[model samples]
Target: MFASITGADKELLSCITRLPSFFWEGNWAEEIHLTICPIPSLQDGNDLTVTRDNTGCRIEYRLPVHLFRGLGLLKEHAEEKNFFINQKMYIPEIGIMTDVSRNSVPSPEFLQSLLDRMALMGLNCLILYMEDVYEIEGEPRFGYMRGGYTREQLRSIDDYAAGYGIRIVASIQVLGHMEKVLRFPEYAGLRDSSSCLLAGSEETEQFICKMLSSIGSCLRSRQIIVGMDETHGLGEGRYRVLNGRRPPIEIYLEHLNRVHALAGRYGLNIAFYSDMLFKYGSEKHTYLDPHMQLDEKTKELIPSDAQLIYWDYYSREASLLNDMLACHRSIGPTVYAGPLLSVSSFCVQYEATWKTAGPALMAVKRQKIPMVYGCLWHDDGAECSDWLGLPGMQYYAEHAYTEGVVDPGSLDSRFLACTGLDAGWFRDAALLDEIPCINPENRWPPNPCKYILWQDPLEGLYDADIRGLSLDLHYRRTAQLLRRDLEEAGENGAFLRVPLALAEVLEIKSALSGALSWHYREHDMTALQQDAAALSELYVRVKKLRRLHREQWMSSCSPFGWSRLDLRYGGLLARLETASDRLQDYLEGRLSELPELAVPRYTLDRCGDLLGNGIWKVYDKSVSLSDG
Candidate 1:
């Protein structure tokens, strides 16, 4: 179409032409006159309108460079569907947070690519949740050995994000979750406990000021997320030793007031989680509980300007959400609800995420909240890859824009068009956990594939739970199915390699489990030889899987955190070799018996839940190895 565009509207045209599907119809020879004008009262000045005429089309986009890009995506969507969207996003802020604190510090280049994808999805903001993953002046050992981003690197990322109409908000801990910073001798005095900063301490306030000063220098966004979430024993630690036996709420308010003052000095708006406020006041002590009450005294302590973020990823009840929203509104005018992508689990729970976030979004829309965002957290080691959370991100974006019910078919199409991957296949890969036949209740917190794969082979503690299932056959079939999907995936298959390799590793490991069980049960000579041979062959597959995993890790993330994967796979390989050698020696009659293999069968409470709050703990009691 022949289009005349001016101002920031020209940037929108540039972005449209860059779309991979833009050239599908050859050159645009159609006579189409397009003009994108700015609207004054657009939602947060982000409203968009597209009207078409016989001569051409006119798009009235909002001001600010970022809104231009957002409206650009809407125009592209409307053009593709052959229908104009006279819609304004109800929620003005749509953003995402990357949990760099949990591990996996994404490189600046990778983050830029992510921002490109976010623009296509119509996301307007990005938050880097860096507890200590960014360099602060005078803090040499702060992010030491963890590959934190330099000041220049963060500034470049901010500038790039601004081009796409995305604001890069800085999220840092002011009161708690300072484990990395507290480890150094210099910061040890700032500790309230291991992961929290001492409340009502001058040294702690000075440290927070330094953090704010350093972060304000690098980032361009005016909004700062001062993390005051999950300070379990806030005033019970070093604060008690210094400022004897005070109620946590008083101490918390004192610390928050100091931090809020510091943030104000830098001319920044502050936002923090509302968990601690309700947690200290309520009997239930939970975020989503509707019955939890916040006393007026504690409410009075909250800073009038500070925005309270109510984050919930597990609640499905709309009534409970409405109640939580009401509770937050009582506290402040600037309140945001944070739904989740469910990436904290070792695998993405697509259904759970949709079920929870859908109702949560609808509730927020009903209340007409000013801002809402989805979080992709890597809590506790960030074992799952970020790519796995795309489906959930897409789900949040589609729902955030439209007030009406979304069409499932159109959503899938848009996901494929924007991401170049099948939404069905992406969500289905999470089903790999089903092969282990774990109790449905226990499937969460930890993806069984990850837990089982990393379990010590010599111990095999979780093995008894899967005794009845044909694990070898199931895992092998699952691996083959994933391989077929990968082959059909074409260029997009590169992202599939990590999961595919994990499935392949599970197949060999499952087979090995069966072999080991047989040797333990029946001490026949022929069976021992067969088991030894199988272990030798499977050891090769383990090595191959390790190499594949390392390749994918290095390609997708920085080198700073690959050691976790290296140690995991490296330990698995060493154990595999040890098992193979022991079996071979016994087969050759060098030993009288494989005493470790000869274990008496005992029943395990398989029906009970195995995952304890998503963290894996090794069994306390040791398994004895007889030297027969």
Candidate 2:
């Protein structure tokens, strides 16, 4: 297929030509020509129109993304073989922030694919949230052995993003969320808490300078997000010994201003998560405090140009989101961040994600906020492929691009045209967590598949909570559905394979414990034999899933930190074998009954409805319960 691009520079033309072949497959024209002519009447860089005839398709767009959007329309209406489109974009910065810090930094090739997809959806920004996964000069301990990207690598990615009119913003930690950096002996002097840096320390000041200099030297975008959210025990550790029992607000503001000053040295615009501010301001010490008050001194201390970002991933009401938006705007220049709910366990929580993002996006638009991005935060392991967020990204784009309300039909057509997959298939993957659906909107995002797949079958922690849920049927059906979709998944089969493999494991495992407990108490030899056979089948299935997961990890992420998941899968496989042996002994009457069966099962004792978000982890993800 011959392709000709006009109104785009040689660089951009090269970038577009290199896009995956499927991007242009729908064009039936023998000589496909795309011309991005400027339309003075159109909104600057936000409005575009495409017209097609026998000669070629002329797309008049002010911005590169708008041009791609025009091309997107071409493919969307390809079956018509002739069409015209005029679209005016709503939000200027429809972007995504992918967590590179949480043990899953995307490979450059995958990053390029990410850029290609974002551009197709007319997105104009990508924020890489690198807590310690980015190269910093003279800071060997910063991202050492963490698969951090080199300076050249960042520059290359930024250049690629620029071709599609997308900016690459650097999201790194300057205050808290630095456990990876501060854990080393070399950087211990800067530590105040386990994850936070010492406030008002001379050494910490110098470290901020190095961070700014190193990061600013690489990323093309002037915007930088220095995470200052959740600086728990802010003044309690070494900071208290030095600064003496000062308020968290004092320590946080002082350190943030210092970071703001250092950022200015590199001409970098700074933004930080604003939760700590609200947490400190209100008597309740929570972000949702409607009565949240910042003292005059606190308000005066805020940097005029700095942006305070409000991030929410678990709200369904637009009114609640609007109130939070109001609270954030009262403090300072505000940016909004919502979630794709692709964190923790092994799947995207679409019910939580879809419900929350809709209201959040509506609230942002209602306030006429120009910039908003969806956060794909891999808080625990990032094992759930962030690639699954494609549907969420498309949902975000359609909401931002369409004025007022989004047309569902348009969303489906555009997403299919942009990604070459039905949006429904990815939404179906959410069934991995949606089974045994309890609370409304899956607000807690019960990720039972994660715990079920790893928990020892003999000593199932959640066995009582799952007794009546019929989860085995749910998982079996989910696996059956995804297996069919995997055949049509094409090159993107890896993404579908991950959830499909998980569902296959969960189908057997969800019910295995009930069967084991039943047979052991009854001492039925016939059922004991069946249990042994089931465990044997489970061991093979688990091994296959582990191998598939490893491939999924290697294909998209950095090589480092994979051992964490590998070791976890290894332990599960080992436990499965042990369970099989114990069952064999019980069948032979060597052991009277499995000891675990004699012990009465109990519901999640203290945690109740929210027991680790349905994921079993030794280190609880709470400030009080947190070990890691």
| The best candidate in terms of lDDT | 2
TM-score of each: 0.88, 0.94
TM-score of 1: 0.88
Question: In terms of TM-score, which candidate is strongest?
Answer: 2
Worst 10 residues of 1 by lDDT: 617-626
Candidate 2 collision pairs? none
lDDT per residue for candidate 1 within 341-391, as digits (tens), equals 445344576655666778888888888887777787876456667777776
Poorly placed runs, candidate 2 (over 4 Å)? 1-4, 26-33, 40-46, 53-55, 407-410, 605-628
Looking at candidate 1, what is the lDDT of residue 54? Answer: 59
Q: On residues 334-419, what C-alpha lDDT tens digit does candidate 2 reach at each position?
A: 89999888777787877777777877887888877778999998876778887888888888888878777664445777887788
Q: For candidate 2, report its TM-score.
A: 0.94
Error of 1 at 245 (Å): 1.3
